[model samples]
Target: DQQVKQNSPSLSVQEGRISILNCDYTNSMFDYFLWYKKYPAEGPTFLISISSIKDKNEDGRFTVFLNKSAKHLSLHIVPSQPGDSAVYFCAASNQGGKLIFGQGTELSVKP
Candidate 1:
């Protein structure tokens, strides 16, 4: 079964606008959530994260909000830039660093 799901395969947005991406999970046992930004053929870089105890986390231009009751989470990017164009992966781990990722949401920031 797929524990994590990113429904959108891609999203395109203007450089100065807001971009939002969504994700869902099936397992409630997951206690930690993370978002990774990746470039073509490259390893994912950590963006932001939140513990099960928190509802929202933000870092610079990126913000992640978690709704534990609905088993859902979302990522928001404000004033998106061309450099923000990349694949975004949402991951979760129960204990250690081992993470399960979504297929990915490709964001294209048009300048």
Candidate 2:
């Protein structure tokens, strides 16, 4: 069974708007959450991450939030630009560092 899931397969946002990507996990052992952005023909690069101890973490235009009780997490990109359009994958890992990834959400930022 898939431990991580991205309910929405895709999301569309206007440039300069906020883009929100969501993910849910069934494994309570997961204590770390990470978001990766992948462009076509390229490997996924780390975007942002959060620990279960913290509810939110922010970096420039990106933010990651974790809801430990709900076993849910989200990544937010503010003022999204065309360059931000990509496939985003959410991953979770426990102390062992074994990562479980969501299917990924393709975000389209329209200019």
Every candidate's lDDT: 0.94, 0.95
lDDT of 1 by residue, 1-111 (tens): 889999999999998999998999998989999999999999999999999999999889889999999999999999899999999999998887789998899999999
lDDT for each residue of candidate 2 in 48-87, tens digit (9 for 90 to 100): 9998889999999999989988989999999899999999
Candidate 1's TM-score reads: 0.96
Taking all chains together, each candidate's TM-score versus the true structure is 0.96, 0.98
What pairs collide in candidate 1? none
Model 2 misplacement above 4 A: none
Candidate 2: residue 8 lDDT (0-100): 96
Q: Pick the candidate with the highest lDDT.
A: 2
lDDT of 1: 0.94
Our tally of clashes for model 1 stands at 0
